[model samples]
Target: MWFQNANSPIMEYLLFFHDVTFLLILIIAIAVFFFFELIFMPTDPHRFLIDNQSIEFIWTLTPCIVLLMLAIPSLQLLYLTDEAHGVLKSFKAIGHQWYWSYEWGQELIFDAYMTSIPYRLLDVDNRIKAEMAIPMSVYVSSTDVLHCWTIPVLGVKVDAVPGRLNQIFFSLNRPGIFFGQCSEICGSNHSFMPISLESMV
Candidate 1:
């Protein structure tokens, strides 16, 4: 469950960035622990513990450099992933107490309720295609309380607030079944309200 299988370009980039940051953090942590070990049990009695300007500079500058390395790519990904420059499909998702209602750009609207049993793939795709186009742009909002629309593999999540529209843009890497759920706790049946996306070619 902890492992992530990325399904889109945004998700792939996010996973790569996470690994890079984790590696950098691990290296820094190990180096700092080693330095502390040396200080705590120094073999030389004359080893200076207080007045090390060079060591201080190195620690400070190293963190700044690391931050820069992480920040630059993060900012780039933020802009690149956020704006749907060439979005062809559009949708609106509204959150209710325990279910989700979706409206397509073509004016088709419906409510989706979760179930343990899976629907036929062809039927699901046909229904979705009757409403939306590929590479969708989704707008989110809540009808009652706050909710979070999240699809982990797709690398898309946005808040659904009352009277407020939050948007996310994503393209399906391939045609398949993707699942998600309301990330926010809105009501008693929140767990039952799952999301299913059937992307068509």
Candidate 2:
């Protein structure tokens, strides 16, 4: 397979950034390997090894320019991810030892637990629907110990710390089922707590 699938717009941007950075690192690694080979060559005269100001300047300035280019998009994505300007609905998630409970306002609330058998998707007492391109704010907290509320496809990972509330905002780009799991080590049944989001158009 090419890579893990991306569902949301934020995930798409993240995947793009990952690919760009990976290519840049690969190029730098190959160039460094070639430089080392030339340095350790036995028949090398080393005549061009002298300090050249132009070459030094170009090398230094090139990295700065490349970093600036990356920084622009990097910062933009960061702000976009953090922005919850148009959020219409708010949800709350409470993490427990081996299960997760979600509350949507005061109208709906349910607990999610792991299934006994292997399946394509996770099991939840209630499956929340999120509209496409509509921002939603999710507040996460923990009832005991520490847990994490995460959704990989939406690029959301918030720690559920006791007495501390962490919030994250996300919007889905299309209708699909997305899955995640507790990213933190909370307890023995940490592997059982799976998160699933059903995005609807």
Candidate 3:
């Protein structure tokens, strides 16, 4: 619920910065594209009010600036992966066709967790926790076709490509269960590739 609970003092600042640097740029870009595509778009109208060359230059430079804003912090975040670690614990999440495999690693204890989604997932009975039991710091990936392991609350998303190990390191800042899914298109049961996390204190 990190996206939903941006009401605190510290998180509000982080959310503001996140929006200024990411969401705003995306909104602006999409609005510009929509404007070009749908709105005030005269019948074969000329761009830049004059020449095609000017319109081309404007579009080119605008995206360059927007993407530069996007990439600068994006690369910074990727390069400095562990700077935000609350503690030193780690977990591993491995992706299969219809479910996710979780490996929880502690200095003293390690447990393997396996779980799947519940029926009527949209209208569940208990919203307090997840149907699966994935522990924190569970590094997750795929075993076959390409998929993506994403936990938005943890601010972590990585591709689950086959034959390759992609890792994400996150400890549970909060003690509860988290849920995610296979964010990439793979096969017939791709939508069933759900992920879960149970944060232990």
Candidate 4:
């Protein structure tokens, strides 16, 4: 699959960008193929065209313009994804050997262990629950080794390094159960350490 279903505003933006980029790539590929066919064909019309300064200038300038077009929105989305403002709640996720421990404020704390039932490795005993459409932040850190807390639908990924906390901010757009796993290669049973989130309205 190219991407999981987008359930957050940031993921929507990312999908839009991906579509535009794919369209641009398709158009460029076709144009290049057409040009190659025209050049190699036995009965070519522009056979005498050895050097065309205008064509060269156009190809160069067109790529520059296309790059600028991609870069502007790319930078804008980068800023938007990195921006964490007006966060209503915050949670701390600590990565252990093969499980995730979440702390909500100082009172509520729980460990999300991979469960065999339900969704198998994708399910967990305890899920991180939060309200939908409300901006929330998560501080991720590791206790033993490196790990990555990633939720594809939410377009949130943060590295969990020992002694260092990496934060990610996102808001769920819909109410459902979203699943993820530790992306980094931590150790044995890395694939078993799954993350699940329950977004509520």
**lDDT by residue (tens digit), candidate 2, 35-83:** 8888888988555657878878988998999899789999999998888
Question: What is the per-residue lDDT of model 1 for residues 89-136, given as tens digits with 9 covering 90 to 100?
Answer: 688888898888889766588888665455532112212331223567
Runs with alpha carbons beyond 4 Å of true place in candidate 2: 42-45, 117-121
Give a tens-digit lDDT track for model 4, residues 158-201. Answer: 89999998888999999999999999999988999999999998
Clashing pairs in 3: 91-137, 91-138, 91-139, 92-138, 92-139, 93-138, 93-139, 93-140, 95-141, 134-198
RMSD of each: 3.6, 2.1, 7.4, 1.3
Q: How many residue pairs clash in each candidate?
A: 0, 0, 10, 0
lDDT score of residue 41 within candidate 4? 81
Clashing pairs in 2: none
After superposition, which runs of candidate 1 have C-alpha atoms over 4 Å from their true positions? 45-50, 119-133
Cα lDDT tens digits for candidate 3, 1-201:
138552122334445568777776678878879777854666755444565677778878987887787778666655655343443455555666655555544433232233334532221122222222232243556677788876566656788777777665543445665666668887887765555555454
Q: Is candidate 1 or candidate 2 better by lDDT?
A: 2
Query: Candidate 4 has which clashing residue pairs, if any?
Result: none
- Alpha carbon lDDT of each predicted model: 0.77, 0.84, 0.56, 0.93
* Candidate order (TM-score): 4, 2, 1, 3
Q: Which stretches of candidate 4 lie over 4 Å from their true place?
A: 46-48
Superposed by TM-score, candidate 1 places the C-alpha of residue 63 at a distance from the truth, in angstroms, of 1.0
